[model samples]
Target: MSTIRWTEDHSRRSARWHSENHSPLPRRVVVADDRMRADHACRHAADGTALLWRGDFHNARQLLQAMGRRLDRRPPRPGSTPSESFDLHRRSRAHRAGILGKVLVLLEDDYTIALRRAPDVRLACQEAYGPPQGPVIVSLRELLGVIGARQWRVKGVDVPALDARIHPHYGVFSPVRGEYVDLVAHTPLPSTIEHRSVTTTAFDLGTGTGVLAAVLARRGVERVVATDISPRALACAKENIHRLALSGRIDVKGPCLFPEGRADLIVCNPPWLPARPTGPVEQGVYDPDSTMLNGFLTQLTAHLRPGGEGWLVLSDLAEHLGLRTRRQLLAAIHEAGLRVTDRVDTKPGHPRAQNTTDPLHAARSAEITSLWRLTSATWPPRASRHDPCAGAVRSALRRGPGSC
Candidate 1:
């Protein structure tokens, strides 16, 4: 446990501190006042020195922004391919975050962050850092992020499919991306699952905001068991369920991937990328070695009733990034004793996909999000129903939001 040490000439002091990415503690630190220039700040940060800002809080923010602009102006790597450019871009952004993180801000023992233009972020801090025992130090960039997250908590993410708002707690992933949720929303329930009594149960693995679970309930599923390993996610899901008045219909639990007893339907939207998350907050976006994804596949058949269906929502961006292959995904499913019954593919409508200048735009534009319907491999694929009217409607949904 590395702690940040700051001792004034008059009083000795120390506080619980560590870099966001666990970078080595700077061997040299300088007290930066309002007079420090962006060039000088950039030089100090580039040299791996910490800058304890004693200046106005707003001014410190300006200096951090200046450093960001300087980093952005650096020349692009010459003759890099789109993939290489994408990789380089991620590295550059991370580097910038590290540099900006050196601008330190202090949190008073009373939970008041000592800086100008700083809002009362005590609730936000408590959510992320737990109750502050006493005074502590944090980066200005992170403080801003906390404030932004607080705003997000208040505003909540709107799920048009569910016709409700999912208030995301700090550290829980927000459902701003709706295409995948649409896949779950518009998906037709399994006939066996729907016809088996009035109460058909489904499990939402890694349920974040409970948006998917809520969508399932709205689509007429009677009982939904939502499970997650994140305490924050569990709380968020429960809160969202309560807000939608679906508390009785959906059960939220923590520290587990699957609930006991088989379900008629199981759905999961695991992290697409198979890399380690740099921080706790990144867990929703990156899964080291595709643990959750593979784990869900391998265990899905056992938890699914004989005629049940498993919906796996995934993206092919990893394939585009050369991280994983389509063949690998197919093999994982087969090894899990599951086979794809049908798939609904949709292109992302996010702004990044249309932004040609983005380093990963090519891959983003080429990305396809698929909702795979899975069942026991021993059981043959479901017989296709010959209904042109239904096929036309499903074809439109499969093509995505605007393809029709």
Candidate 2:
């Protein structure tokens, strides 16, 4: 039996099974077997109950698919405000995902996951759950994700910005969303810095796979200091830099949010939303109360060299979702003592943006990603700064943080 917490209370409870889905604490969990009918199982799940399958592996998958079809035919709430409607849609999707993810699979005591047609996912599992000490139960749906992620880790994501593949670890954020990376690659370097003898250095805060850092290094930035709070992310970034033969140019550091000292340019792409993540994997997508984003803005000026620019890559989806507002963001920026000099905007061409059936489609369709070029309000530039694109490179080469 696995010891898990009952979310309602702080008490610990033991169960033979646990959910592997994104939800960490399911309110209701019930055990089921091969003898259980799919209709009965579906009804139980529809009532906000969790079904832990201990049945034929393939049958569990089929049951999950059946539940999915039912959810597709479910009607949307009518007569609700746009915000309420959007929230309802989000809830509906979350409910369906939770129900379908109940398909349970077993992990053998020897650290092997047994399921029909399942690929070898020991490495991926280790990356997530660590060495499987003994037999444990996990969600088959998540196992499938792990399997797919393993393939992604092997093949890597092709970054047009760097003209190279950035291999991401299982838990690290992948560079699948290329629009922001493209913005980073094309954004004009700030002109205030005199880029002459030594090359100007840049800082890439929250560098997950180091894609942006690699992009900066490729753009002739002499050095890049990539920082992250996760050791796993740091390791992943280092491996990618090494793979690209830019390890000598880009330095990976952390357990820290920002590298020590300052640089000519700093790039940060915080999680686009201000919401709580249910699990570690979701942290790259959802930020609680916009903590990381705010932290970057508040401390950015201190780390920027005189006349330096801080590139902030963000999306307006949260604003559309009503979770945040433009006024609130602008106020935060003002409070941080930073002012946006200019911004480059791009519309997302991802599949979700085109799917009208998606619950957040309205927001997704209207979503605009912008790279805000910002500078400290109090920092006086040595020279007049105007056209970011027409500036000549004349800065002395500087060593990045840690001088790797």
Candidate 3:
């Protein structure tokens, strides 16, 4: 809990500082209002000074926009390689966010804004921050994001795969990209395994909004267990499962990746990019050092029953950006004692893919999202663990059916 202090009326007043990104508290703060010029505000922000808004709410918003326009006039320097370009773009974004975030606003004890003509944000604040503690100061940009998230929650995102809308929580990732969901929905479910009569059980790992788990259930997987490490994601998934009347067919579990027992099928859609996320919401898009991807592959075999399959829904965008390579991906699967059975690919239909002006547009346009069907290399009764032949058998199986 950090506090921010500013001088007003010849006295110093302080309020609790709230930053979701845990940014350092401003060292210097000054009262700013409608009379403040956007150019001066931009200069102060660049100098690392904070502006505590004491102006009309709408005017403050305009000031923020003005600052953004000024910053955008100067574009980031181009790099020689795709990877370098990506790095530069990320740094440019961070710089812009830092500058725009300098404009701050104060929320009263009960989550009310005292500014003139300010909209009632009590409900939105409560939804994002839980119970109001006391007077708190937050970046105007963050407060606007909170308000937008509330609207999104109220007007749920439509998912054609589920034929229903999924209302995403404040920090939970929304399934706005339907191509990945479609891949899961349309892919043929594995046939009856060795002794089982049908695909009776399934697991959806890191199930953000429970969208994939719900899709599995709707596809007639008798029992589906969804797991996530985020508390907010767990709660969001549970609520969605109940809303869709699939509670009987699905069980929401975990701060862990895998569940207690083996399942006939396991599914994972890890973060696409191998980079550190800037905030909670970005967790769905950026994965530091491909941690989640590697974790899923390494532990996937243990959680899968013999003759069962694991569906890894991933994108080649990282490869396009020069961050990862196809050979490395194949090597990972092989090292995990797993073999690729089949792969289904789809082009991204998101707007960014078509935006020619975006810095990473070339990579986005060339990206291919695939659902890789994998199975344990040593399945259906192989040599004993003590037998040296067992190692050879597993190695041979890795190159057997789907050698990439």
Candidate 4:
């Protein structure tokens, strides 16, 4: 086994040290030379080390992504059938995470935008990655995303409320899921102290970029505490809040679900789809169905004030994939000691929903995003119900668990 070492050299024009080949070390690093190799750069296991690349600035980035793909295609162990869904899912996720961690290498001072026929990504790079203090390098994959998102950010999805400007961070899921936000905005705040006195506090769980929190504040909620588990998301939310000048009304928190007190109204647009995301953006779009959603459901009762309802924003696309049945969801809610008081539904009007050429046409075409109003109730855990994947919705519904 070759020993790896980390050293800080002022001579290097890039930032961060990486190891390309430790059994436990990060598997790949982007050097000034642009070769994807297993090299160690950190001092004291990432204390001080730098990698330099030597390929076309654009291609260098593609290589990093290629390395990510390479890392993803690891062969399954012999005689180990990854068949049980939960177990397979766990293994796949662990493998993907390990590869993702390895793909992110260090950056240098003079950052080059890597891609085929790449353009000037300097501005975008500076915007997301920040200006390099000296000669340094960063994960080319991250840099490429910055450029792509920079372009996407420039051509932002118009937010009518905020003058139609939404600048998403480097790898955040863009604000394409506007339908749900619109639903929450339109849903009347159930008669609460916040509505009567205009001083009710609300919690926006998993507030990505504070979009929902900002919306809640705009909708007249006096105080909105936004909680997210991602530090980058927290920073992004803070920046957006400041940009919207709603800083006083919105407070951003990291990790914790509820802080100290219950809210008159708690709104959460947890991951709507039930699947693991392949990358960062997928995190916003997919949530392994019941993983995060289940957590939010079980804990919601403890955080909701008397007569205050928890607004759960969910999508029915999972039903299209035959992945989950409505009963499964309803049962979770009921089991959480919560009852659905009412529901407001919206049809997805995106292009893909009607695009005949899309792969997820079945789900997208018939997709519905709903805000289920949950109040206190007595729910019990029944035996698992028959799943909808067996082809008939009626049979599934008949045998399904009571979700409401």
Candidate 2, residues 295-361, lDDT tens digits: the string is 9999999998888999999988888888888889878888999977766767777888889877667
User: Candidate 3 residues 2-54, lDDT tens each?
Assistant: 98999988999999999987778987999999999899999999899999999
| Model 3 stretches astray by more than 4 angstroms | 193-199, 380-404
RMSD to the true structure for each prediction, in A, is: 3.1, 7.2, 6.1, 8.7
lDDT for each candidate structure: 0.81, 0.75, 0.88, 0.63
- Give the least accurate 10-residue stretch of model 1, judged by summed lDDT: 385-394
Model 1 Cα lDDT, one tens digit per residue, 1-404:
56677656666667766444566666666678799999999989889888888778778888989988998887456325555665676677788888888888778886686666666878888876677788777778877777787888889888788877888877788898888998888778888875796468999999998999999988988899999999888888988899899998999977799899899899999999887776657888899899999999999988988789999988889888777887798889888998777777777788888997766767888887778888887765674634221222347455565331
Question: In candidate 4, what residue range of length 10 has the lowest lDDT sum?
Answer: 395-404
Question: Of the candidates numbered 1 and 2, which has the greater lDDT value?
Answer: 1
Rank by lDDT (best first): 3, 1, 2, 4
| Cα TM-score of candidate 4 | 0.67
- Model 1, residue 214: distance off in Å is 1.1
* Cα shift from native, residue 278, model 3 (Å): 0.8
Candidate 2 off by > 4 Å: 1-36, 46-55, 75-82, 114-118, 192-199, 381-404
Candidate 3 Cα lDDT to native: 0.88
lDDT (tens digit, per residue) of candidate 4 on 1-404: 23223333444232344222122433333334444443232221233222434455665555555555665565333223212333454465555444434334334355553433546766776766566554333334445566787787666666655454666776566677667767776677867754455468899988877788888888888899999876667777888888889999999987766655888888888877676665666688778756778888898888877777789888887765666778788788878988776666667667778787544455577876777777777433121344322332322123322111
Q: Candidate 1, overall lDDT? A: 0.81
The TM-scores of all predictions, comma-separated, are 0.92, 0.84, 0.92, 0.67
Q: Which candidate number would show the highest lDDT if scored against the true structure?
A: 3
Worst 10 residues of 3 by lDDT: 387-396
